[model samples]
Target: MGPARVAGRRVGQFPDGSESASIYMNSGTCYDLMKNPTKAIEVYNEGISKYPTVSLLYFNKAITLFNSGNVEEAMTTTESAIRYNPYHASSHNILALSTANSNKVYSLLAGLYFLAAEPLGKRASGRLKVVEELIGSNVKKDGEKKVNISMPAGDKIANKPNDFSSVELMMSMSAALSYSDSYKDETNIEQMKRNLGSIFGVLSETTAAKGGKKAGDKKAGFGWEFYAPFFADLQKKDFLDTYCHIIYASSEDDANTQWIKDNSCLKKLTTLLK
Candidate 1:
């Protein structure tokens, strides 16, 4: 949502600047909307050249490459985005969708990444279910350990020559104070507790689950809250605010905006947050 719209923007102190801050912010979006991925990539390269720390440029460029059928390039660029900011939801989505389940770690983390994206997150629950089914069915039917999932047409994560692993990404998330550094909020602790529960809850499904811990187990492995603190503030937003943030990518105070609240899945998630 718009809440993260300004994510990659930073003030240019004249001496260290490349393009104007606003230009970097809008250029890629304009190019993409105009259906010119080449231009978007060019713009993103310019932005990254000057502001290498801006994760959004990498994210934008990754998506542009993905759209242009440059799957391998997209995967690499997505990793760069995540390296710059482990919580870049867009980059996570691109990687999850692009990376095939041939890589077990990304397969698992892809679902987690979708879930972690929160309201403004990637709507990838269906993909998770698909991955789950593929994983589950193959292990039961045959002795095959590598599960190749069938992706929806035009929605594949990536194709050809991909060995990107999420090992380092996991370490970055598990480290303490990562999210707190950005999210300074009151409900951070409570939010972390719930999120860790959900993460372990899902991970417990696989035999590869660390320490063989259950979803809600306290010792599911490492100190999850220590590494994943962004979940805290992500869960504290009101339903409508969450809705607006995700749908519009903006935090324009939508508490009073009336809308249907009949999504069954939304109900379950709300209960978890409460």
Candidate 2:
């Protein structure tokens, strides 16, 4: 979906000003899902202003900031989200992802290993592996087994320095590191490397074992992280044309704005955001 359609769909006319919060919040979600983080941020700010106590507004804003690579602002916004709703799962998840990318090892580990363990990290590991396989790696040898590697103790690895010349190698290594069972250890750089290599080895084995092809190995498919490109592809293939027609017919309106307002998806999303 394009930004204009998304914006129009979610910003339906509400009779009461009190409903403006709902409208803005829903608009923010549509913008975020469409990969327009700046628009999402703006709508979320408007939502928060209309309903100061709505924790989901802040949480969604934080997510948009994080996805936009505004780590500092995202962190601050996450703190506010937690302050408003301490038990919000999506807030914690976004905070965790942001912390992981920012090199906040302790907090990131806590988020991934403890708070968001069951729902986030394990699923993320699977997704990471899928991406690795798509990038032409075999993943069968890894087989979900935890690998142990011995290494010297230090803040940095002095023993087997990385050769960062190859972008493909670096990307593969980064993806592999996400599946390492002990990524939480700040002092185990060598162990991290070894575990990553193990993952790589597993990918190689899986590829060879399968005689060179695996299911869904064509391209990077749809996921939350790459929603924009996916949405663009859908538009290119005229999928949105059918969707818009259905939405319009159901609501008796040419615009999807009214249909989205009557739908309950955004309500569920609000709970998730909180």
Candidate 3:
């Protein structure tokens, strides 16, 4: 059975189940997993309204909001959840993801730095640079106390952080810059290669130290597979071709020969090129 139905069954067995916020939160989770975010939000909202003091309910609602693409609302809801319960890990994780997806890249990176720094410190630099370059400002000044990066946009648009999708975008941009023939201008190519080499070198060393394969080394042996679709969609032919070569070279997969035939994304990309 689904999460909501299971939660409902569990609640039905309890004498005070009708008044339990956790049951509602669980129901919402089931709905979310079913891709019914609106229903999930409604259920979470009801739970919060019924049990105003239940911090977890607020967290659930905030996550629902985020999944529904109402990131700013999600941010506020998460703050309320934290205010009610400071020790909520899911709340922190959701907040991190929400913030990362909301275009508040700088703030999100800072939060990630604080949350994952101990275990992830060595690899954080490249991710941190992604935030700085995308946001055009450093939260950490050379000789000043670290400051909260402010979003000049109104709160509605500024509160959320960059999400996993944003990270994928960064990877795509990096791949494009690394392989684009536009950089074939002798001077430009050399500079682009150097920058890409440095970035990938750092990433490789860091992942290696952690005993993980380098970034983008998936089982399919396609580096930046997720990012490849974006570059293809954008009609970045040179980058696309180079990316395909890299993946095929790395994997020696004959399937790579029929990449456009195999991947719907690449097929759409071919249309874009035409």
Candidate 4:
């Protein structure tokens, strides 16, 4: 899909409308459009140097790397992006695509995140379709235990010396709350939901433990951090309604089968259940 594969995956724009940030992202995007992977990587690296905490910069850089055939490096950079922000749906989506053949469980977990975080995203439908195809595949290696999120997304990523993003440390505590053991016997979307619910449980526990303060001092309410992507730009009740619906949704429930499409990429992923 060329470098353009990475173009539509961007989610959040530069913060505060900083001209420098826009220049960084715009230059990267421009380079990508021009099919100059070298220049795109340079621009994104520059952005990372200037704004070390900006996860989107890392995400864009990883995409360029992937398009340039630097698959290993791209995986590393994508993991960096996720370290900076667990809510980055695009980062998770990229990871899912990059490592699908290696780890079916991890790939599906990433897909679950991408769908949950960017249910209404423009490019998510296509990506979701790809992930759904993982259903019924016997890709698990022998001795594979629970979801092995311990390693980076790949060998190359594991080799890199990564500094834990503050976000990573904060979210790690919550990630520990994931239901790693509950879905060992499930497959496809059922397994996906178990992971999804596990992540929610983690976020719920972490947010409560933190007394409701997010990384930027934003006050969260109850399980808001777990549902941060949805709550980021919503009324409390609307966010709550969305969260409750997803947590309770079922494939057989007609209202949910229809409603999920409007609210998430679940509609796009429904084909997996077939």
Candidate 5:
């Protein structure tokens, strides 16, 4: 029988009930580190069979799948991980990266969620870039016009009721508007605040109209359930400026850095969440 199939073989190895799941996660990681992605997947699957609700197992599996270039499957598995443990920051990180190309809305939400949970470190720096890219993905500077707008095409971004299509379009428009003469003179911090404010404003409106049902309500998915609601609430409460600064805490901009020091908004944000 497979090592994972040996039920209760190493029970109580740790004081807590996490030992069995940890073993499987570690075993899978070893395989992944050895460049045996197929075997790593098998091990992760076996672990998942026994611990279907263990987010770590699902997270490890998703990592292997993502590294092996199975992005769709990786995204699916990462969603499972988030479903089981919404607070798993790394799962949100991978989900953002996996879906960034296929679905900008999901990518932006996941990336934001990850940054909220882990707003420091190398992982956060990279995630911040992804979030910025998602925000700026649909705008351009064409000749003397100085601002050109574009929207992602295809059935994936079609305008379905209760879907992120509107939010996506609004985000693109926000990006284009940021370059308009009215906004062109603002600092990057102000520009970002405006852009994200527009995006989150639409998100709040859509999520509220949907009665805040679970994710997958319409074309929305885990992002709607886990990340959107919180951000929507933040927008509603007018705390989006605090949030933007928190995620961009590493910015070297004098205004950004000064804002972080001048305000207790970061502490207030954490308190509000709790």
Candidate 6:
């Protein structure tokens, strides 16, 4: 029989609480694996109704929504998961991927949060690639002699302050600068450090300008309240280098591995995130 049937058969044997929540989550996952997203969402929602605070239920539902191509709903459900448990790494992972095209900075913020919690895993490896793409997405090379820089125009369209336009422009500029003569000799890791550091610095400054406010206007939400502060603090604490290495650790890059071995900041970062 299917996992849902198995779970149904054993339902009354276990008490209602976290363990029961896990059964729901597992049954929902079984449905998902069986290519039944509708049934999966039904099971997850039932679990959420019973254990309102279980973040995994929301996370599993978000995954189903995303894989089924209901991206907007997936984003909304992931936000709910984050609301219940801010440190849910898989929730952050889905959020990062969902927002990568629509919101660059928010994707990076969530990507970093996910990596911080789940470094040195298959998930981290995939997220690191996506984060690197976001950091470099704006810069395109036409030839050895020509480069194109693309910047998002959302802030211009909205005509608003405290938006991500500055960071987007900064990212474009930094990526363009990577092709400059002065930076041409730098290794891929070095370029990543500089470009990623530039992005983080701008976000940190934005956070400071907001004067510790939990949210900006329409553009800011969970990213402002949670991710912005976390990464901003990392930038401020001079842990950006350490962080870059940590997120890239799954790549097994010699430099990143060596840096992690030489530095004491990983423990400190873990503590801060906790």
lDDT of 6 by residue, 64-99 (tens): 999999987898799889989987788998998887
Candidate 5 regions with alpha-carbon error over 4 angstroms: 1-19, 157-163, 207-219
lDDT on C-alpha atoms for all candidate structures: 0.47, 0.45, 0.48, 0.53, 0.77, 0.77
Higher-scoring candidate on lDDT, 3 or 6: 6
lDDT per residue as tens, model 2, 1-274: 7655655555645535536566676778887887788878887887787788888888888878877889868866775776576566566566656654332221232242222223334544443333224332312224556532222233331111111112233334454555556554532223333333433333233221123332123221111112222223334443333322222222233344454456543443333323
By summed lDDT, the worst window of 10 consecutive residues in model 5 runs over: 3-12
> What lDDT tens digits, residue by residue, belong to model 1 across residues 5-85?
333343333456644745665767776777877767876887788888888888878888888988878877877777677
Q: Which candidate order results from sorting by lDDT in descending order?
A: 6, 5, 4, 3, 1, 2
Worst 10 residues of 6 by lDDT: 208-217
The per-residue C-alpha lDDT of model 5 at residue 41 equals 90
TM-scores of all candidate predictions against the true structure: 0.46, 0.40, 0.41, 0.48, 0.84, 0.84
46 Cα displacement, candidate 4 (Å): 1.9
Model 6 TM-score (2 dp)? 0.84
What does the lDDT read for residue 48 in candidate 4? 86
* Model 6 score (lDDT): 0.77
What is the number of backbone collisions in each predicted candidate, taken in the order shown? Answer: 12, 3, 9, 0, 0, 0
Put down candidate 3 lDDT per residue, 133-239, tens digits, no spaces.
44333122333333333233344332122122323334334444433456546342244333433333333333311234333444211212222233323323334
lDDT (Cα, 0-100) at 9 in candidate 3 = 67
